[model samples]
Target: MAASLKMSDDKQETEIEEGANTSTNASPRPSCLTPDRQALADSIMESVKASVSKLRRGDPPTIYIVPQIIRRVKEVAYEPRMVSIGPYHNGKERLQGMEENKLLYLHSFLSRNPDHRLVDYLEAIEELKDKARSCYSEKVGPLMGNEFVKMMVLDACFIVEILLRFYPRCRKMKLVKQQREELEQNEEDLGLISAMKKFLFHSNGFEDPILSTIGMVYLLGCDMLLLENQIPFFLLQHIFKMACPVKVPHLLEKMALDFFESRSMPWNEKIEMNDSYYHLLHLFHSHLLLTPTNSKEEPNLSCIPKFKLKPNLSCIPKIKPVLNKLKNLLPCSNKAPLLNTKRRRMIPHATDLQLAGFKFKKNEKSNNILNVKFSHGVLEITPFLIGDNSETLFRNLIAFEQCRLKAKFHVFTTYLVFMDCLVNTSKDVALLHHNGIIDNLPGSDDDVTHLFNRLCIGIFHNFKGSYLSDVKDNVQKHCENKWNKWRASLKRDYFTNPWSFISLMAASILLLLTITQTFFTVFPYYRPRSQFLIIMF
Candidate 1:
């Protein structure tokens, strides 16, 4: 009986232990309270939250200056001189004189709207400060926090007031006249430019004893073109709205176009200037290329896929054929075509084309610089008015294109590249100049040629969507034609002058006599030679 009780007690103990084991296996440990696991989970959650926050900020499109491009070109071309528009050049000693003018303009703007407090302008600028900073590719440094906002406020109010000055009603106002007088006085005080030099200027390259108003305006205009020196268009619009509130449609656009009308092209007159432009430079660039009419003639590269090569070594039967294929695939291959559907091509320079019997003529009616055409041995290019500010204008435009994101076509860069290829030397520039296609007002032909050669040194141009591609192909084909070569040879060798013609005729006669002598010498034993000798004897 004692042994049976012991066995039963042991079995009960085993069953109880089994039930405990079952319970332990069925119920998971509460991980929520576990230190290590909870810490890991919390870390993962924090990481996800941080990522979401970053994603919400999104990637701002790059609208700032490309350092690589600026380095390749002249640094002075992208810099401001008389005035600095934005934070990039804000506080420079050279441009600080203009700061006083900016402040006075802002003061005038506030005075014009007596009901509007200065705090209202500050609040509007403050609201746009973060968004404006985000537009630039570089981060707005901590040093530029409040100072940057103040600069924007001052600059925006100044621009609006300047634009307002052009209005007919605004021009007649006493305040406007007084503001103009103050600006003139400031310019005179700063020795910026004399009134006589300002009024005397007509052409671009006219020499003046001192810094003229024309020079100052050109420099200031160039400074405004710099990518780093741009204020957001919306910020300006916001300030103009709060200050003007005149319900004038496209007030800023009208003001900008009127201010820089010399650089404006008639082709873009129909284009609606709305909210698409990011800044003044962007607006000016759009004015350079965009048109309202949709034409199939305009090259579209969107459908074309970028060229990429993949070598399948395993499928090749022989190394020789593979090597041959590779040679053609390589961009440096001499046998390969210089231009293809996927790549940019270079055409002969203006001098070479002229030598090859290609006639260059300027299309006076066409105001668009991109409207270049080649057909039936004639190359027609729209005249480009090169000026003192052209270098600055082109360099800034190129920098803008270089740093742009999702840009479908680089019209300005392509034009620069095309011109670079055409103007290889002073002789080429002279040809273009003599043909009235280029207005060489800035400097000599050599200077213009050198400028163009260096302008597109580091810029890349895709010919697929470029209007110049067709012109290039036609010019290349005409240059490569055998008949054109023969004609050029005749022109150079036989028809250059009276002396050249006489020499060529003399050479032809000498060649005929030599051929006759050679024929007799080779056939000395022939019947023809003996018969001719007997007849002569």
Candidate 2:
């Protein structure tokens, strides 16, 4: 009876084990998590879903933080030194000093038309707050609702006031004078009109903190041009229209350009205001492209007059041979063939190209500084000024091209890359300076060289599709021709200086005399004395 009972218990245990194995095989194992951990996972997933939905509902961001690859090369260039316009650099301690100036300008703007209250501007900004927020790439969580609206109103007012004050300076003729007189008559007691008068007429005793110092004005201009330091153009326009009693279309754009213009940076006044601009920088860039020489399409080399070598044969006797050789070796007269097989990222530097029989000429006809042309053996480029703030300007322009997604051409970036290729050392910069193609305003040749070299350090360019592709390929083609190379070698080796040319001439005479003497001696040896004399006679 005991043996039978033990066997029964073993059979029951085996049956239970078999049932558990069957259940395990039928389904997957449950998650090994406690209740709290499961709840945390669910919450994390829900947050991710909510963020994705929010992003989907948002408009495409027009303003962006400069990419790390580009910003890391020159962080200071993208950072605002004097003032911050947008939310990207709004509340920094270093830039807080300009916040008071912003408030003062805001007060001046409000004082322009007493009929338009501050609440009116606030309401306008309030209505567009969400739209404005969507223009920024990152979430402006730190500045919410009222705070954001205030920033927009204050910044827009400050910009409008500055432009108003600068308009007289831009146009100082009868029309501007009449407008000023009318404004003074209309609102002589207003702070905005008084400030404009002080800015225009009282240059010697100008008391405004921001506009008093020249360095401050210059720094403020640089800060305003920064891509990160920009408010939406529509906000600026709306605020400008409200401040000005006179309704003028594109008046803000005109005032903004006039305010920013200087000797070193001359803007094309004949700007077409047809397209919508994103901000001040975009407006400036669009005006830059409006110059007659700058075309939206690829440049047609056939239309450009082929450069003819007009060397004075009277000055140099044997230069005709060299000129003829170069003319023969010139590439096709119609257009230089594109280098389709292999991509060329760089060309020879300026000094090297000079040695390779290439001439550099300043493109004075074109106001667009980015317009560069290559034809035959001459490279024509608009003069570029390298000043204290030039790097800042160029860096921001390049950063904008790098960050803006809808930018089709990469104009500034491509021009910088082309400049970077041409300037590798101080000698290259000096060559360009001597040719009037580069105006080194504040630094040595070495500084200009370093500036170009560093401008495109982390920047990417589509070499194959660049507008300067044909220019680059033609330049490379000119440099690679065998005859041109030989002529360049001859000129560099022998005709480099007067002494070398004289030495070459003397050596050629000596060789000719030696050959004549050898011929006479060999003729006498080959034939009898009488026969050799008869032949000579």
Candidate 3:
């Protein structure tokens, strides 16, 4: 999970670094996450501790205690005695330190022991799903309002990853059980797929929930191989199916493609290769490479039939009711948390830092490698500061990943990872965090770097989501271009295939027999070789 979060959160950090910490000398390459930064983080933690202490002793407990309580939850190993005393079995009201500790212990037992079998990450996600369902059923139900919805959304988002990646066997089992229980009911509770659509389309009123859930969903759905920085195995298999003489629905593929295409901030030019490369290539190939010397006219585009598609026969009706239910239940819509496209803004250099490649300038050497692979790693944005020389500009430290990758390789889906060396918190470089990493970087000293670090590693850490769009347009085109070239070569005659080679041999033998019979009948004196051999035998 942390592996997936780094590229995004680091971008959030780059924006604020210039104002983050100005001790006069942020020079050369700035010291990363220093002792000074740690000290500031400690002070912020102390303030939180103090605030929590005051709340625990207050006349009535505060409302926003969960995020803080989550920060301090006792993570104990579970024992048989404690299993009987499970906090989840009762209620959140009865959640004491020991019970929290015991639950943590159970989590650790199920999750961390090396001696135990390797339970899948998807199953781990499902375990989280079960806990989330409890919130909706017996415990803090919707009666508790958005708080209930918020926790469910957060946990659901985490599991969204599992569904997208693992496609758990239990998911099928759960659906069977649900259908059996509902019998005549119209809804199937979405089976995880619905949870995602709800967030992308529903969770608008939420300040933070909408950003992570929708974003992650679209990101994962795009293509796991590119996002995860791994090449797709059996690439030919997928390409053959997509490019087969068989037809595919244009609208469905368009929706899927458009979602992958949406991740860029508007300023970036739609890479000409996007839909153009294939479109142009086909046109160019017909006009130049495969044109008849006898014909002077252009090929008609309409000669090829348009692709028509039908939505999943099984899902069409299922999705309809689910969509309507989400609308009736949530009744809200909000704008996406995307940056403005029109206003052209460049990240200015910081106080003393030097970023090697700043926003695809003339001197750009390599693209930054910020994808799902680094989601768990620390994403620090050391900027080109207030004063820097040409030597510093020439010195390459941070690399950028210019292409949008689809995580289709090993992870569930794909999203783009855009790594700008000179990103700002509010201005230039951006820093981001894993879902839970934010708590480690509190800003007690109120220094900008201190605050930035906290925000990256510790604040609203690790909010996973579902995203269909990707930011790395270059990578997608690269992947797609490669797919097209491979597909173009697949238009060989059937006999070229080993399987068809045998069929061709059989057909040839049949044709030879037919020709010999015709020849014998046309010229009666002519006896075929087969007839002479048969008489001799």
lDDT to native, each model = 0.65, 0.73, 0.27
Order of the predicted models by lDDT, top scorer first: 2, 1, 3
Model 2: ten consecutive residues of lowest lDDT: 332-341
Candidate 3, 23-109: lDDT as tens digits:
223443346767677567556655555444444443221011113222232112111111111112223343333334333323332
- Write model 2 residue lDDT over 489-531, tens digit each, in one string: 6666666677767766766675556556656755676699998
**Candidate scoring better on TM-score of 1 and 3:** 1
Q: Give lDDT: candidate 2, residue 110.
A: 71
On TM-score, the leading prediction is: 2
Top-scoring candidate (lDDT) = 2
**TM-score, predicted candidate 3 vs. hidden true structure:** 0.17
Off by over 4 Å in 1: 1-59, 142-144, 166-215, 264-267, 292-345, 405-407, 489-502, 513-537
- What is the C-alpha lDDT profile of model 1 across 265-308, one tens digit per residue? 33455557678678988888887786322122422324535445
Instruction: For candidate 3, give the lDDT of residue 466.
Output: 21
